[model samples]
Target: MIGLSLNRVLAVLIKEFKQLTRDRVTYAMMLAIPVVQLTLFGYAINSDPRHLPTAVLAQEDSRYARSLVSALKNSDYFDFVAQARSPAELDEMIRRGEVQFAVTIPGDFSRRVARGDQAQLLVEADATDPSATSGAVAALAALPDQALAHDLTGALAMRGQAVKPFEVIVHRRYNPEAITAYNIVPGLLGIILSLTLVMMTALSVTRETERGTMETLLATPLEPLEVMAGKLAPYVMVGLVQTAIILAMAATLFHVPMSGGWLGLSAGIGLFITGSLALGFLISTVARSQLQAMQMSFFYILPSILLSGFMFPFRGMPAWAQWIGEAIPVTHFLRVVRGSLLKGQGIGDQWRELAALGAFVCVVTALAMARYRRTLD
Candidate 1:
């Protein structure tokens, strides 16, 4: 009896191995997903900002302005790329998002200094992205104290005037404290939702298809929309539970404050969950088996993580990369989440983001419906 049981167990094991080998998607998940995730996280994840593009709009064209420009260029924080001749050009560069900072020197900078009048230097920086903006501002703030002070001392000696005391006040609007947690927590919401909702729906739906239950369900009078809705309702509850857990953890453990109203935040989360579930339903329609659904989910998840500004600041990425990021729904959702939670921005403040996300939901849902209809046919 023991020998017979062993033979039966071995037969089952052989059959399972054959099935596993036959599924290319399973083999890919076993082999490719780990390596890809590791390489992406290891190389791409970094908080330290570097090589920020900066523009100098020097009107002085004097020795002092040249010295200041030289000082900025020598520093590791900036790349002194262009010189703007006028405020219009400077404004264009900043508005076009070509440069993160524009260090402007007044035409009478040297003349005013010679007469011992306090000369003002304008350092206008882009504050759209909190992290890169902070780094650029910090570097610029230090420059006046270090380089300007030395230059002022030399100018005093040249003019035989005494070095007068003055205050260097820094104005950091948008995100004054440069709080990293404030920036990261909101984006994390979108990422966590995407991973959980998308993976769960994709796997669960595919499991039904793999087990032959999908055919049984289709035999019922239920419409495709009804089937999709039934499959998604349970995962929506799961997404809500996960969102609560993450929000609590973020507040209590990480001390990240939620500046927006809870109602608005909840609404945003609901929209995000719906969009992600639609994406998962779309994936399920494309995939024939559970393994294929999982692989396809990973492909979606990878881009969402990398290009969504969750791991890296969006402005810090190259232009081509930024364009790629724009294609992902998580990118728009992150902007809404972060802007609302950290910046205390209301719907009016982020109407653009809201519009974009709404459009994404409409587009993805329509595509999912089309795909689902096709699959049923």
Candidate 2:
């Protein structure tokens, strides 16, 4: 008789099923997150970035120089965004990441080539994100042959090779090896922490309300600051643990070098975690239920994924998009993580990002404290 109760079990199952149906946000997340993540990750995320903004500094007004410029544009890598008046202007463009490449055709390039003299072509690329620049740089090697095909005829027929003989000197700075993992692995830290820490803290206050504990907390002497600290302090440790795991795996598996000081990186990570916790707390204040908290968290999460330079080069996006990206916390964090991890940037070099994250934490904390209600009434 005590072995099993079929009716009771069915009744409990039915009750649970009904409860599941009422949580519409949870139900929708179960179905929507996969489709949305798959769609965005599969389609929007691109490794081999294209249509890069480029500036041309064509010193010689020869047909061959013009052809080379045209060939570069036709390559689909460079978009020919501007014409540089001088090398300094071109350098400025590349420095600001306003242009990925600057094609500098030296004076008398065609004349030098027509006379079979070795001509040097300078293709300066913003190699900060090596993957973005490498593809375009490789295409430059064949430019001399393609651009001078028309010139390598008639009187140049006998010396066809000489008519278009040019050397492409590609300048790949920052990441010289063009390692994809170097660019990708460090960014994973921001993304994973955002997903976990934000969502976890987003649920904390909401869970208290759903379980009838919010009123109990209101009855106690605890202030909102105390509650916020209690909720976020443990998660700070959790974030540190997550950081360690990600960094360890990145180093052991992908061989990502940690050239910067750990103290600097740790400070950045701690600040980022604090900021994420503050954001989550702010969400908890707005959401009426735990499910609403989760929904609100995703509202922030998706944008962070798209605009944070994790999947694509940050500078590759348009000016308007870059402005939007700057508003995102993850964007600044990505800069710090990548700079310290790959470029060996010291604390001084990373002060800008650290300062931005610190400011962000302060802002979010103020907003969270302002939004947090002391009572369920």
Candidate 3:
């Protein structure tokens, strides 16, 4: 048995701690990532979304109609963002994601209420992301009583005391049954691709450099484009295989609907994969080792999951965080994947996201090429 040496053990412990502290990036990540991610995600995530964008279709100028709308506005769940002139306009707003709820007050709402009759208010909710609108839908129950509370007086007093004075016609669109998997399975594609492709490529160049193979490669007449293509091609293939597997699993296990044409979906996912590879290549230029590459990749993981509409509604986040999410490649990719898979959106419908991914690839590739050392000096 080896003899225990207190002094030697103490010396080793101190040396290890010093080395650990010297690794600023690792130490900062250890301290900051957990705390910051927890706090940030806690505040950013809301199962019950508040101040949801709402469209009002008021054909009547009745005080009662205005009061009912006011009640919804005051409840902190709905914010009247637009006024739709027709039912078709309101439905279009919901489809385009311009608004979450469309409140339609029939022209005779005030007349019905004046006669102590139950007035019907149609609230059509874009429930594609059911979690976002559930709270607001539940909150609508209190509106009828609250709307009539002050308005009912003298002969109209019976309306105030009625158990239910108005009917809230809730039309939950998209996932009408409010399926959770409908939202999650599509998002997993982005998250998985980000983890595998980004982290793998992030370490690719760094590993070669650390092993001194980069020096040998630079001795050859290979141009940067050749080198980049050689390194990226394998990962791109891997990404496609992974994409196929995930999509199959999503369809079979989660019953995720894949609605769009295969060509459009493949094009979008292909662009996303290319962009992720470029981003990882850029990270590889900055990272000195596999551990550093992983740390950098891990730095993005939380933000991808939390801010990219994966764990929560994207529009639910604050403006600054939304801006950050918008800058991330996964955010755009999620839109492409989800829109194509869920809504049957083609390239014409999702061209902007594909273009954004293309732009990301260009920018990251440029930065990576600039940072990549040709001479390995």
Largest lDDT belongs to which candidate?
3
> TM-scores, in order shown?
0.71, 0.75, 0.91
lDDT for 227 (candidate 3): 86
Off by over 4 Å in 1: 1-21, 27-131, 145-168, 171-175, 261-267, 373-377
Per-residue lDDT tens digits for candidate 1, residues 1-377, read 44568788999999999999898778777788787677555655444566677788888688778877777776666687888988888866664456767778888878776676776677776554566666666666566555555566564754433443222334433345666776677678888899988988887667877898888877778787888898899999999898889888888988776776455565677778888998898888878887698789888899798867787877566566677778888987887776566556566555666666777788988888887742456
Model 1 Cα RMSD, 1 decimal = 5.8
TM-score of 2: 0.75
Would you give me the overall lDDT of model 1?
0.73
User: TM-score of predicted model 1?
Assistant: 0.71
Show the colliding residue pairs in model 3.
Answer: none
lDDT of 2 by residue, 169-287 (tens): 88765566778788788998999999999999999999998898999998999999999999999999999999999999989999987876566688899899999999999999878
- The total of clashing pairs for model 3 equals 0
Between prediction 2 and prediction 3, the one with superior lDDT is 3
Question: Which pairs of residues clash in candidate 2, taking residues 3 or more apart in a chain or in different chains?
Answer: none
